[model samples]
Structures are given as structure tokens and as C-alpha cells.
Target chain A: MSIADNIETESDIGLSRTGKQREFAGSLAMPHDYFVLLKPRVMSLVVFTAFVGLIMAPGNIHPFIALVAISAIAVGAGAAGALNMWYDADIDAIMSRTSNRPIPAGIVAPVSALTFGIFMAFMSVMILGVLVNWLSASLLAFTIFFYVIVYSHWLKRSTPQNIVIGGAAGAFPPVIGWVAVTNSIGIESIILFAIIFVWTPPHFWSLALFRSDDYKKAGIPMMPIVAGNRSTQNQIFGYSIALAIVGVLPWVLGFGGITYAMVSVVFGMAFVYFAFGVLRMSPSDDEMKPAKKLFVFSIIYLFALFATLLGEALWTILL
Target chain B: MDNIVIKVTRVEDERIELNDKQKKARRARNIAIALLLGLLVVVFYFVTVLKFGPVVLERTL
Candidate 1:
């Protein structure tokens, strides 16, 4: 059977399992399958960062329009993610970590995934353009294309610097968020972009270290695969330091206050500690405790950074 | 020798079947996406160029 048929069967069963009465009552109503295409965890981060950027900007955007713009950006990010999954389905099937994704699990066809992504991408850019501004719309369009074309198709297979170069696409959401509000880039948004760009390497490399075998099996030359663990660890350390410095840029540039500075300093120290653990630990430890620590810490690092920005914004407004 | 030949023939047949289905699915999906993209373009053009459309921030001031 085709993957589409499998998905239909699964959905039917899922609905039936709930109760026959409910299933009979709403037999024609299909669950929104496009939700799976969104990669919700990644979308959440994109939304949060964009929200922070929007709030931190100097100008005022109508609340409803701001919400729409953020939602559009999130949808666009998810669209890029779905398209990426469609293109990389072959390699994804080989990697254990991604082997059970909707495409490979027979829950969504690759073609369906591609269609969903393309639809969302165009809709998002158009919505943001109409409801928000052309600057934001154009940035959103370029970000989607950059991720799909430049990063995924061109850089991923050919270069070790894939994450480093492609990281810029991920970094653009905050700047896009800023533009959505003010319709222009500024020091604050650029600093936020820098923070994410510098943070991407260490965050991703940690996962690459622990999942080295999976990456190798997929024939993807990750940092640990190509450059070896020690070099990857050293690179992680260097990026961590740069990330820490960038984390403090908003405060230093006088766009933020003491609270953001203090929170950033503490966040940076925690990140450096985790990176140092990765650098100091032995490769043969097998459990990959340090790399795992860094991976978990990385998420907290971003959350804390943005949360602090929101906190500062609130404090300034209230007091 | 006969068994090996039969197994190889079956595999080839399965591969060909999968390829045909994949192609059909691809065409259907592409057409759907193209329609949606065209709709999006029309919406954007109307919003930007229509005189009675919503005010754009860039145009004001």
C-alpha cells in the first residue's frame, strides 16, 4: 500500500479506537494532517525568538497584527522544515534518530510533505506581506529559500561548514521579527541574530557527537565524523566562548539593562561549563554524558536568553 | 539457479511498481501546490496594488 493509504488506515483506527459513536458522528472530518508537517518543537523556538525580537523593537505594532506576523513566521519555518524532510527522506530513513519520522513511518508521503511545505511557505510570506510589511515578507521568503536551497541542497552534503553558514538562515527570524515591528533592522535584532548563529554550532555539534554512529550510517559527514571528536569538541568550546560574548552584546550596547546583563552572564557561564565538560571528557566514555549535558543546556540557554529579554521589556514598561 | 532467477524477477517487479506509484503521487502533489502558490500570488498582488486595499506601513510617511 502507499504511505497515504497507511496514514488513512491509521487515522481511521485512531478515530475508531476513541468510540464508535463519535467516529460515526464525525466520520467525514479528517484530523488536520498538516500539523505533523510543522515540526512543532522547532516552530515553538522560532515563534519565541520572533516574539522577543518584536517586543524588543522600539516601535509599536498592533497586537493582533503582531500575533499574525509571528504565526506567519512560525508557519514559514515549519514549511522549510517539511520541505527539508521531503528532500532528505532518503538519508533520514538511514539515520536512527530520524528513521521513524512521519515520512519514513508511512504516515506522510514525501510528495505530500513537499506540497504541504510549499503551500505553507507561500501562504506565510503573502500573509506577512499583506498584514505586516514587505520588508518582513521579503525576509521570510529569502529565509525559506535559503534554508531549502542554499543550506539543505547546496551546503549540507558538500561542506563541514554547513551548520556555520546555514546557521544564518535560522538566525534571521529575530531580524525578520524586528522588521515585522519596525520595518527595519537595528542593533538589538542583529545582536539577537548573532547570539543564535554562534549558539547553533555548539548546540548541534553536541548532538552530532552523541549521534556520530547514526550520522556515519547515513553517510553524512558531521563534525565528529569528519574532523573527529576532539576537534569537534574544541570547535564547540570556541563557539561557546563567542556565543557567551554575543549573549552580552545587547546589555553592553545599552539596548538592555542590568537584569538582561546578569541573566546573560549567568547563562554564558553555564554554557561554557557544559562546553568545557565536553572538551575535557574522554571519547571512550561511551555514555557521552558531557555532550548530552551540552545538548540539554543549549535549549535552556536560548530559552533563558529570550526570556530575559522579555522580562527586561516588561520591567521597563511597568516601572 | 531457478530460485535465484525468480527472486531477482520479483524484486525488479516490486521496484517498478513502487516507482510508478511514486510518480503518480508526485504529479498530484505538484499540481495541488502550484494552485495554492498561484492563489497566494494573486492575493499578494491585489493587496499591494489595489487602491482601496489595506494601508501599508512602508507607504505611509
Candidate 2:
């Protein structure tokens, strides 16, 4: 039987037919379901960071090879996303924030998701290995394994530090992209990874601030759910400060140009301001406006930082 | 916020009928898979049997 078979109409639990249909509609969205599995918003960030990494590396890579490498990394990232959704299907079903996901919606079966993830992981790594350098391929493989086994299977739900440690999986894309071009790890890639690693907690904590109830209901140990809102906010502030400091490292390291430095400093200041907002807001404040604002701005901040890096690198090379 | 709760009562087994769009998607997916498998076979042939190797020596020095 498919995973969808386990999903019952509300009538099985004795609800009215229309009510059951409504619930089914909410849970079992089909057709365009695979797109949802990709976590497209997350994919966008991964793709951008990986692109920057590829462009900023010292050596010249063939355009076609770079294209293939980036595509492989994107597939690998998507595979990780699919595996995460598969493993979290049960919790996803219970959380209002995630109940509309493909698996929980009964649009895709759990086993199917598992198969798709494994297939994509192998295809991605293999393609990278054959067409790109082995170093990049190995890194991509490790990233997939870390995301699926270490983070999804083990760390998440087991600890509130899940985002902190699991963030490594997301941070590796740029490094992998860098290695794809230069065939070697560099200080620049390490600095990029560090910025993302520190940036994750504040980004996710802001999300948790607003979605704590969903996490509480799902029995997940997100920071805001495990600790109080105040503690989570404090953690967000600390991580934001760390992220800002790290964001400036690429500029100071001579890997970035003056434009990048100026943009990074400005974005870092904005990040700190948002972080302070999270810290100062009352827990009883309706809608968790500060947390939501910080979450939105955090995304733009990362994109701007990477974009600025790319711009500066191009400028330096051309001028 | 008043949360609305809805339910589904399966008329038959918990099987959902795939709509026309889903059918088209399945067909497209099958074609893509077949093409990929074919490409893999050709790549394997070129790499292992034909030994169509990289011209690194020509490029290096």
C-alpha cells in the first residue's frame, strides 16, 4: 500500500463528510507536490551561495562543467530536503506549519520520498564525480549523509541545538562549490561556511519564535519550545552578533572588495538591529512581529551578502 | 483564531484517483527516466570500453 493509504478521511474518526473533505484537501494536496518537497525557498539560497562559491574560486572552470556542478549540488540539496521531509512526516502531520507538506498531504508516499531522495543523492554525487572534481563530489556525498542521518534521523527532536549542528549541512554547499572550481578548499570558503553556520541559529530561532506552538504541539525540541521565548531570543541575539562578525571576515580576509565590505557592514548592522528587536520584544506581543521581521530580513541579508561577494569578485577580476 | 477542522471519509479504500494532470506528469517522468538511463549506458560504454580518456597530457605541457 502507498503511504497515502494510511491517510484516512475524517469519517473514519467520525467527522462529517464535508469536514473530512476539507481536512483531506488540507492534507492531501497532489499534482504539484514534488515542487513542495524541494523546499524551493531553501533551494534558492543554496543555489545562490553555491553559485557565488563557484564564481569566487581562484581557478577558471569550464562554463559547462560549472553548470553541471551547480546542478548536481542543487539536486543533492533537494535530495536532502526530500529525506528530511520523509523522516519528519509524522511530526509534519501534527504541526500546523508543516501539515501542508507533500508527505503529510498524502500527495507523496513515504517510501516514494525515500526512494526519490536516495536516487537523487546517488545521481547527484555520481554526476559531480564524473563531470566535476572528486573533491566536490565527496563533499556533496558527505553533506547528504550528514543531513539525512546525522541531522534528520539523530539530532532533530533529540536536542534544541539541532539547528546549530544541523546547520553545517546547509553551510557546506558553498565549500563544495568552491572546491568544484579550484579543486581545493580555501580560507574564503571556510569564512563563507562560518558566516552561514552562525547565521542559521538566529534565522531559525526567529522562525521558532513564531512557530513555537506548532513545535510544542508536534513535540519537537526547537529552542523556543524547549526554552522560553526570552531564552530563545537571547540565543538569537548572540548568534546574530556572531553571524555579523563572521560576515565581515571575507572582506577583511582580502577575498572581497570595498563594495562587498560596505554592503556586509550595512547588512550586519541591520541583522544586529533585528536581533535586538527579538531580544527586547515582550513575549506576550501579538503576532511575534519582531521575530517575523528578523526572519524575513535574515534571508535578504544572506542573499545580499553573497550577491555582494559575487559582484566584488567580478569587479576585481575585470578591473 | 478559530481553527476550522475538516475530515475526509473515503468512499472506498484509501486510494485517491489520479487526475489528468497527474497522469501527464507520470508520463513525462517515465520519459525522463528512460532518457537518463540510456545516457548512463552510453557514458559507461565510453568510459570503460572505448577508453575515451581526458587529453590532460596534451593540455598540460
Candidate 3:
């Protein structure tokens, strides 16, 4: 059965009560529910990328300052996630993938989540500005604003290009990290941003291919839902090519070393291969194995690419 | 205004209190969160002032 039908069935079983009823039915939600609102997995990726940026940027930062900067970025990312959850609760309730989210599941009141998110956002930005440099703090604030206001509220429901444009929010972490250290953005930091920005479309589109029905049901304008599978697949392939080139650009420009170059070349090829596999698959293939494979590999590709850069930076520092 | 206020208070008291225990739990959670946030602020303070010391202080001042 479709996810829509599943949601209907779940709702029929008393899960569709008003938010107030659900909120009052249970005692306070566990701490983990609050954590879920932060979207920890996504936050982890933000933290890792930001850390890499901090490490690779020219100059040394006191370890404590670095820790504070990374912490502020993480909290800011989490705050954005919370705000996204709060705003998207209505659609999130209907989507099977998001049905269990804190607000939608009624574990946390929407107001509480909103307050928490806004509070964290303000606190994190202030801390970063006061402790680290104002440059990094401003970037973090902009990242949060872009994700919560521009992407979540505006673009997500309106356009198939949502992820493409909204991807900038995620791209800023590395730039923030770089700026935290160098107190300015450089060519290398811009390259880091470009890598994630180009990589996001193909990575997200592959997931959308398999879960197009979720977007359709939720009235979200994901690429596969708005533009048919073939077009999305082609776009994914095109973006993957761009991603591969941009992913290796740091090494090519001599910002990164041979180790980064090797990892980028291998993973870049792997990413393109997966996208090609998705491209070649017919729409009638219900399993969507190729798309699923591409989605999973895209994550690994990013992690490996960034980890290579981090490793290279550490090597340079230690040796 | 006096009569209206009296009636509102009476109505508010008569309203069913569903899940009084749950309300308590929610209050507890909020308190916990407040404490955690306060701790985080303290940590941020220590990291900024104690760890970075005069360099950070000089910049801020």
C-alpha cells in the first residue's frame, strides 16, 4: 500500500488526534524526542564538515576557540533543524518518513519547539560572535536563516529547485569553519562550499526518486514529483558530473594534497557511476535499487571526500 | 467588568483537567531543559574566558 494509505490507517487508529490531545495524553516527552527535533544525523554532517574547514584553513586557532566555534555551529545547525521541524509539522505528519518526528508525533508542542529553536539560534550566534569572530557568527546566522526561512518556509513547497538553492545552507558550515580560523573566506573555503552545493542535487534527487510518492502526497515540490522520473534522473546525472569535477577542484588547484586528490578521484568516479546506473534504469523498475544505491553512495562519497581533506590537513600539521 | 471576571474565573475552574500528571511532567522537562541551557552558557563562558585567556579578552575589549 502507498504511504498515504499507511498514514490514513495510522491516523484511524487514534494517532490523528488533535495536537493538544496528543500532547496532553502523554507525560513530558523524553530528552531524546528533543534531540530528534535537532536532526542529529544531519547535525553530525554539519559538524564534521565545519571541523574539516577549521582544520584546513591557514593559521592556528586555540583549541578552545576551535571547540567553541564548532559547538556554536552545531547548535546553530540544530536550531535550524528544530525550526524546520516546527514549520513542516503539518506535512511531516503525512509523510511516512517524517511521521515519527517530535512535533508531528505530538511529543513536543509546536510552540515549545519554536521557542527552543529560536533561543538556540540567538544564543549560538551570540556566543560565536563574542568568542570566535563576528565573521563566522554572521555566516552561521545567515545559514540558519537561509535554512529556516528561505528553504524550509519558502522554497520547499514551491519549487523543484528547492534543494538546489537550499543546499547553500548546508554548504556554509565549512565556510564558517574556515572563517572561524582565518577570519575571512578564501578560495579554498569557496571550493568547499561549491563541492557540497553541487553534490546536494544529485544526492537529494536520488532519494526523491524512490520516495516521490511521499513528496506527491505531502504536496512538496521535489524534482521527481514535479518533473517526472526521466527528467530527474537526467538532472541527477548532470549534477553528479558537476559534483565530481567540483569535488576534485581543491586538489586540482593545489589547495589539497595528493591524498585528497586520490580520494576525490576515486569517490568522484564512484558517485558518477552510481548516478549513471540510476540514469540507465527504467521508471517501471519498482525496486529503484539503482537510485537507492546512488543515494547511499552519495553520502559515503561526501564523507570520504571530506575525511580525506581532514586527514591531509592533520598530516600537514603533525608531520 | 466585575461580573464578567467572576464568571470567567468560575468557568476556568470548572474546565476539565485532563492529565494533571502529564502537565507536571511537562513542567519538569522544561526545568531540565533550562538547567541544561544554563550549564551550556557556563561552559561557553569558561571556554571563551578561561581557555583563550588574555588574547580573546584583548580582542573583545
Candidate 4:
């Protein structure tokens, strides 16, 4: 059954027939439901990248300031996730993969999510501006706006290249972190941004290939939905190649040390190999195992790459 | 359909009203969250004050 029909049936099981009553029922959401709105997993990655940026910058910030900056960035990322969930509730309700989300599951009222998200967004940006640097604050503001307005509202349903352009919003954290420390943007920060921006297409497309049905049901113009599986696979392979190069650029450019270089080369090759596997798989393969493998490996690849960078930075400081 | 609707509404109302124990636990949790949020605000304020020193305090005055 369609998601709307499912929600209707589900809500009717324990609530009144009218929409208003269903909303009222949802208003009694628990604290955990509110936490789910923050998208904790995504916030962790944002916090890590921003921390790396802060540490890797030329100078040091006071520990308290660094903590505050990172916290603000984390809150900002969570705010964006909440806003995305708020705006995409309709599509989210339809998609099997997203059907259990707080809004669609009748755990939280949509209006509450919207108001909470807006309030958090304003709070984070103001804290970053007043307590930290305005440059980072402005970047954080733009990131939230771009993610909510440009990507979620405009590009998601309208274009297959939604992720390609929208990826910039995620890529801004490290740059914001760098600005938080130095009050300026540098080549190193831009390279960090480039790594993530280039990494996004391949990373997200792999999942899209595996879950194309979800996007189709949700009417989202994901790469695999608009373009055929073959086209998506080919594009994944192409972006993987670009990501491999960009992933290694830090080591090659002398910013990263031997440890990072080794890690990058190994993981970059593995990424390409996974993408190649996806490309070679037959379209009729029901499991889409290769795409799933690539999707899982992509997450590991990003974490390992950043962890290596952080380790190298710490190593330099200690030695 | 009418009977089902009535039954569902009753269940929803019961779900919304927490038992005494659940209410106590929820209240405690809310208090903890409020304290944590307050601590964060205090830290931010002090850090701002430390960074800007007398300038911030003077501006407030």
C-alpha cells in the first residue's frame, strides 16, 4: 500500500478519523522523538569534520571557545536536519525507507518540528556569531539556508542533480570550523570542502541505486530514478575516480603526512573497486549487492579518511 | 465504523495521559534537560565575557 494509505490505517488503529485528532495524538510525542528530529548520526559527522578543521588550522583556539564553536556547529547541523525532515514530511511519509521517521510515524507533530528547527537554527547562528567568529556564523547560516531552501525545497524534487549541487551545504562545515579558528578561509579549508563535495555524488548515488524504488515512490528525482541504472552506475564510477583523486590531494599537496597518504591511497583504491563492481553488476540483480557494498564502504571510507587526517594532525603536534 | 472511531479516540486519550510514575519520570527528565541547557548558556556567556573582557561588560552597562 502507498505510504499515505498506510499512515491512515495506522493512525486509525488508535486515533480518531479526522486529521486534527491525529495531529493532537501526535502532539504527545516523547523526548526521544524530539531527539530523532536532530538526526544524531549526521550531527556526529558534522561535529567530527568541524573538530578536524579547528585542530588542523595553523593556530590554536582556547579550549572553551573550541568547545562552544563545535557545539554550535553540531546544533546547526541538527537544525538543518530537522528543517529537512519538516519540509520533506510528505515525501518521507510515502517512502518505505523513511516511513518510520518521527513525523511520518505519528510520533511528533509537524508544526512542533518546524518551530523547534527554526528556533535551534537561530540560536546556533547567534551563539556562533557572538561567542565565536561571525565568519563561521555566516557560513553556518548559509549552510542551513542552502540545505533547507535550495536543496530540500527546490532541487530535490525538481532535478536529478539535486545531490550534486546540494552537497555544498554539507561541505561547508570544515570551512566554517577553519574560520572559527583563524577568522579566515584558506586553501587547506577549501581542499577539505572539495573532498566532501566530490565524495557526495558517489556516496549518495550508491544508496540511490539500491533504493531507487523509494525515490520513485517519493517522487524525488534521485540519480538512479531519472537516469537508468546503467547511467547511474557509470556516473558513480566516474565520480569515484574524481573522489579518489581529490581524496589523495591533501597528501600530495604536502599538508598531509605519510600516514594520511597511505590511508588515502588504500581507501581510494577500495572505493574505486567498489564502484567498478557496481558498474559491472547486471541491472536485473534484485539484491543490488554491489551498490549496497559501495554504500557501506563509502561511509567507512569517509570516516577512515578523516580519522587519518585527525591522527596525523595530532601526531605532528605531539612530535 | 462509528464504534471503531470511538474506541480509537478513547485509546489515544489514555495514551496522552501519563500514569503518575511516568509523569514523575518525564518531569525529572525535563528538569535535567533544562539544567543542561542552562549550563550551556552560562558557559557561552562566560566565554564571551572572557574573550572581550571589560568591553563586553561595559557595553551591557
Q: Top model by lDDT, which number?
A: 3
Candidate 4 residue A136 Cα shift, in angstroms, is 0.1
Model 3's CAPRI class? incorrect
Give the Cα lDDT of each candidate.
0.82, 0.84, 0.89, 0.87
The chain A TM-scores for the candidates, taken one by one, are 0.89, 0.89, 0.92, 0.92
Candidate 1 ranges beyond 4 A from true positions: A1-33, B1-61
Error of 2 at B52 (Å): 7.1
Candidate 2 lDDT over A1-319, as tens digits, reads 4545555454354433443444443333333466578778787888889999998999887675687788889989998999999999999999988898889887777776777788988999998998788999999999999999999999998999999999999999999999999999999999999989999999998998898888888888999778888889988999998888899998898988788889989999999999999999997777899999999999999999999998887777788
lDDT of 3 by residue, A20-107 (tens): 5555546477667788888999999999999999999999888878988998999999999999999999999999999999898877
Better of 2 and 3 by DockQ: 3
Which stretches of model 3 miss by more than 4 angstroms?
A1-27, B1-24, B27-31, B48-61
Ordering by DockQ: 3, 4, 2, 1
Model 3 chain A lDDT-worst window of ten? A6-15
- Model 1 lDDT tens row, A72-136: 99999999999989888899899888887777765675666787799889889989987789999
For TM-score, candidate 2 versus 4, the one ahead is: 4
Residue A180 alpha-carbon offset, candidate 4, angstroms:
0.6
Clashes of 3: 0
lDDT of 4 by residue, B1-61 (tens): 2223321222344345556655664665577579868987798778967798788757532
